[model samples]
Target: MKNQSLACAEFSESQIHALIHLLSDPDHHIAQTIHDQLVSIGHPALPLLGLAERNQENPILLDRLSSVIADIRFTDVEHAFQALTTSSTEEVNLEAGAFLIARTAYPDLEVQSYQRQIEDIANILKQRCEPGLAPRQAIQTINQHMFVELGFKGNIQDYYNPNNSFLHQVLDHRIGIPISLSVLYLLIAQRLNVPVVGVGMPGHFMVRLKAEPVFIDCFNQGVVLSEKDCAKFLDKYGVDFDSHYLDPVSNNQILARMIRNLVAIYQKRDESNLAEQFTRLLNIVEPRE
Candidate 1:
């Protein structure tokens, strides 16, 4: 690991393989040194590490290879998230941000495939909808098509399953928590030219129209609610309701909330390392706000 800063091209193929095989060394210090060397080589070591993981019979060596690949991939994800959070544009694509978070868990996810799934759903619903439909009628159409026809519903039995928070998984399974469901609804609404926005309530997430005061609860069969009803629901939960909680949250704020949800889930499962990883991601997106 002496020439840690050297370009990956300087290291020959056999030299890198020698380092990878040395990962099975009995000495912990020696093995760690080899791991660090491979990591320092960065993305260039990925292909060899993947090959070693598949061909190697030793479980320990396989685990080490997997760790190295994850480290390198996570570094790339961090840089991508940083760039997304720091962009100058006011309108960030919510779907893009959600998929980026999903990539943390699924490094090889085909994003376009999932995008097409959502697009197909929108297209089917678009055929049913006519121009200049009423707000309530539009909400009813979406609810019927999404929940009743498509079989999307809340995962109340296993609410904390991490899949409930990931967009791709939610789309695949059609079951998710409030925030993820709201995100799916918002995205579909955007496609149909509906003026919907996310309402980041303290205990629950919902969606509503830009000019209307009614809230649509995507998790519960797209149930409609008035501002007074939302306030009373908050009171029932012993939470003091504030007007700002009903205000539309930006896409970045929604992504921050998603990260925070992951951190809480990992903490609950006693996965301290994963919790810390998501906490760092939260810092990158949420900032001090």
Candidate 2:
């Protein structure tokens, strides 16, 4: 493996500054070359790029710096994600996978801060979870805390917003699409020792208690549903219902699905570059057989 420090050390500070200054060149070819060079320099150039980005007044130059910074950040995310996928563990850490995926959109995301937020929420719910509480009653308590107190809701007004696919953004806004919301619920439930698992049903995502035949539609205010209700949802969406859809998914599958959501969104919006980025992540998570 090439040493990143050694590779970056080849470019003197002055040379890196010159390249950043040239990023706004009027000539497209010159600007493209500068961009490529900065990207190749990788993380070592980030401190300079970030400083330049903060002081930059020209919108074009600022955009170039931002792009380079995002590229550098994604390189790290890709390496970490690959390791997570290739590790020997049978069950990957779902929270870690989700946060890593979020880092793609928010390069500077505070992963530990968000983790602590989830932990705090779980702790509060744990106190409310009384001894000998029935599964359904416990779910009701969780639903109230999540939807009513915390104010998490389905982002129905702008369902296709890309932010809905990011874990940090979802936590910040308290609104997200099905899968992200279900992820939040699952994460908290896991901490509380609740017998809940993510249910990647067709066209919608939910969580089901392990001890009951009940499914909770996190996107819909945590409304409880039966297996038949899930089948109806599938039928309404023109998807053939299969029993396997209710099975718990691994962290790898969940991350792949999140990336798939972004890919489809970007494709629909004609943002080919963004779509390609997420598609690459999807392949990393669930590579072609």
Candidate 3:
């Protein structure tokens, strides 16, 4: 438990300069020590960091800051944007070569569709869950009964199926992938009061559960497994997961994963622009501590 004062007591000019670049907006959500470390860096950066912190919840300020960052020439990336942004500082900068703002593909109104589906999933899960189940317990029950035992699969065709029930399609894997799992996890967790979030993994859409000491891969059905399992799963499919599964991911990393999943699928289907937009979203929903 290092205090801010202790943490930044000996920061050098280089450290401060380094932090300016590393202090990507997401880092501010982390602790005072990180904040202190930035403040300790040098007085020159303090005003900027202070101003940014002051406007933490201001959406306008956020957009402006994001714009400012977009303009800066990212040299070596200092500590890397992911370090300053997510609760877990493990995700690599997959967006380094990508664009800053992700374009909307589903139309603004369609965002509401995501919300509606979320509610529907919640109601269904509520019927199966005990009213007072703990977060982990509820997750376990859902996994055992629905995902694993029942073998829910996300077949691509269900995603395009018009007459099928979205809820039923999701349960049976007709909705395939990152979207279905993302919606499922969010809805079910809402019932249990767990704050688990989702991240769009590269080439895969996955969920991130807020567990002690780390976030987990819930898309694998409440397995709470690590990146090692990710690697193993890829190996089973003869895909080289090691090339990209380098470390445990952050919240943003997971979002990126989700976006990547969509992007890959879209790209495979030749929807170039949608792939680009999702790639941008991958950078947006990172989870910082």
Candidate 4:
């Protein structure tokens, strides 16, 4: 590794510039070798590669450079997730985990922008709720604000789109599948000091107040469901009812589910590359073996 680093360091800026051109080499083997060498040079090669990508007229070379850039960004995400998994902290930051996963596909995502968006939602909810309101009433107020007024809803038409797994997209578009919308609801509800927690039911996701009688189905416009209703919904879906399924999932579990959802979505679309990326991330974030 030391020798490889030294070799990479020996290449001057001019040499890196010239190597960028080699990406367009006619010989496949030579072009592949150049790609590998550029990647091995790591971050130092990014600027030169970016310049080449901008100026290069060849569509083939542009695609190759894009792949290399994606690989580098994936490495950064992998390391970030590794730190999250190996940290001494008791609870993972679910919001941060979601954004990190999103960044695998959206490398230029501005995390703080999304954070502010969530905070803004929470602030609106705070303003809407009256002081000393009943928990049930408070929940209703949140439902009205989030679902009716803000127009957030389940994307039934395109439920399988991978965008539904990303929090930013969920917020921006106001549509998502169960788990992502549940995470969004949980984040905002928790911020308002509501007792809501995510309930990762079989084949569905929802939220419920701790020790409360009702479940909030964010995907269904915060429809309130009883325990029996939850069981019936599970049975309707042909999923065997498990009492444990109604238990609140940990932040790590939530993150794992989000990634698993993306993996399934990509797999159905035959996007093997994306499926593989999320699958590897799932292993890191929720290692079972």
Candidate 5:
């Protein structure tokens, strides 16, 4: 599997058969070879070949680990479109958001309307902030201003489940309430410059503020936190203060967390029909692995 060029005619039935098998190899050179072959042939092997390579396990994640490279190489939206389902979870939503944000940059896609929505959300948050509010204070003010003052019931997770615990517990049922709020918090806080991080703690998805003057928990309605309290929380959850346990998330990641929360909640409710929304969502957001 040395780094060498590949061609389409060079790819025989044997090579095609080994597509999945080669992807599992520790050395990713085989996968790169496949990519070279596709690019050489300029064949319409996108979406399928791209997704297979992405989802299938491979060591030392190569540049091709992303579905984006395939997206750029092939630009086949039709095949990708056919795979879509009704489920649009938060990560899927974020992925969709990325796609939309990109597509809307053009005059052809006619997604300009969404820009207004984004602007509206941003505008409301920006115009309605109290001067000199800390990140925690800002989140609380935003929540209260939107929830109680503006009557935003938001999504509540009264029920809980155990399966579908992918990156953000997309299948867990009990933690969806705070999960959704955390998603909103991350999205809104970024504009406020709060520097929120994600805590992928067992059985729960939470957020921590890294901004100065105070550490805070957005999941608990922007509760101001201390390192001591965080340590206690970790002890209660049986997770030490390991780096992975209390990581912050990005805007898209936050959105993905919310969708995952809903997926778990609905799946546990025995709503197979409803669960599909999240299942399809996972494919779009995380794209398998």
Candidate 6:
């Protein structure tokens, strides 16, 4: 069995070697043909290319191989994300959905690392809560920890940067767009049993206390807002006020909105490949004809 495994490994390595050589071909059509063949080999091509990349002295061949490996990694993430959409659970796991989206840009991201970061914040909030504290007071403590102490603010300077859409990046940089920040706030609030729900307001995202008439705008340092305030903000933006907009969105709906944001950003930047990928993800989450 060992010998057979070794033989198979050698065969795969030999195939990779031939493909790498053809990658340097002068003809564009030949190079594309070689690229397609390697990608068709799928995940198996990744390790072989990694070994070749380490030993390769040619810069052009190395660059081409790197691009191919990236595409393969992205395709793998895309497949996994699509599979999650068809999961048996009624509502998609929000953290998992966000992490899957993050993997598109950060293929090597450690999901547990981000989860731990969120848990740590929740733990601190848990410790800070006074025994039998009012729900509103408890929420204020969370806001102070998240926005003031931790300094998580909106990335208003570069609001359109695709990085703002990634949860992991938001955690690292302490800044993100409104929707990403709102998602982070919602997740932490849920962990702390604060009864917060995401409010997918038009052109703005926020959270609302389940039994209270209060809304929290996470992008603005968790400032509490009244329903009338939300209505006024919407009116100022020329969006008709709809009470339904304040309703708690499902995990799938939040994910669909995130995907839509990414699609718009990519399309604006003329990144058709990425835009198409997110569009497909959006369809999976909210299928349309």
Q: Count clashing residue pairs in model 1.
A: 0
Q: Model 2, stretches more than 4 Å misplaced?
A: 1-3, 22-33, 57-60, 131-134
- Candidate achieving higher TM-score, 1 or 2: 1
lDDT of 5 at 246: 62
Clashes of each: 0, 0, 22, 0, 14, 0
lDDT values for all models: 0.87, 0.87, 0.47, 0.87, 0.48, 0.86
Candidate 6 local lDDT, 148-233, one digit each (tens): 99999998899999999999999999999988999999889878788888889999999889888899998899899999999999
RMSD of each: 2.8, 2.2, 14.9, 2.4, 13.1, 3.8
lDDT of 4 by residue, 1-289 (tens): 4654786788999998888878888899998898888877767778878888888788999988887777667767877888887885688888889899899879889999999999998998899887787888988999999999999999999988899989899989999998999999888988888888888887898999887868999999999999999989988888888888889889888999899889988899998867888898999987867
- Per-residue CA lDDT of model 5 for 13-99, tens digit only, reads 555446534544566577666545554443434444555655656444434534324333322332243233233442334334433
Q: Worst lDDT window (10 residues) for model 2? A: 1-10
lDDT for 202 in candidate 4 is 79
Off by over 4 Å in 6: 1-11, 27-29, 54-63, 130-132
Pick the winner on TM-score between candidates 2 and 3. Answer: 2
- Residue lDDT tens for model 2, 56-87: 99988888788888877888888788888888
Relative to the true structure, candidate 4 has a C-alpha RMSD (angstroms) of: 2.4
lDDT of 5: 0.48
In model 4, the runs with Cα more than 4 Å from the true position are 1-10, 25-33, 130-132
Residue pairs with colliding backbones in model 4 are none
Residue-level lDDT tens digits of model 1 in 147-168: 9999888999999998899999
Residue-level lDDT tens digits of model 3 in 1-289: 1443464566655666455445444544543234334433333445565466456776644544443332221211212333434435554333221112111331212234444655665666677787676666666666665566556555545443321223333543434454445555555575557656554444555555555222344444545656666677668777776533433345344444445555666778786645554554554454324
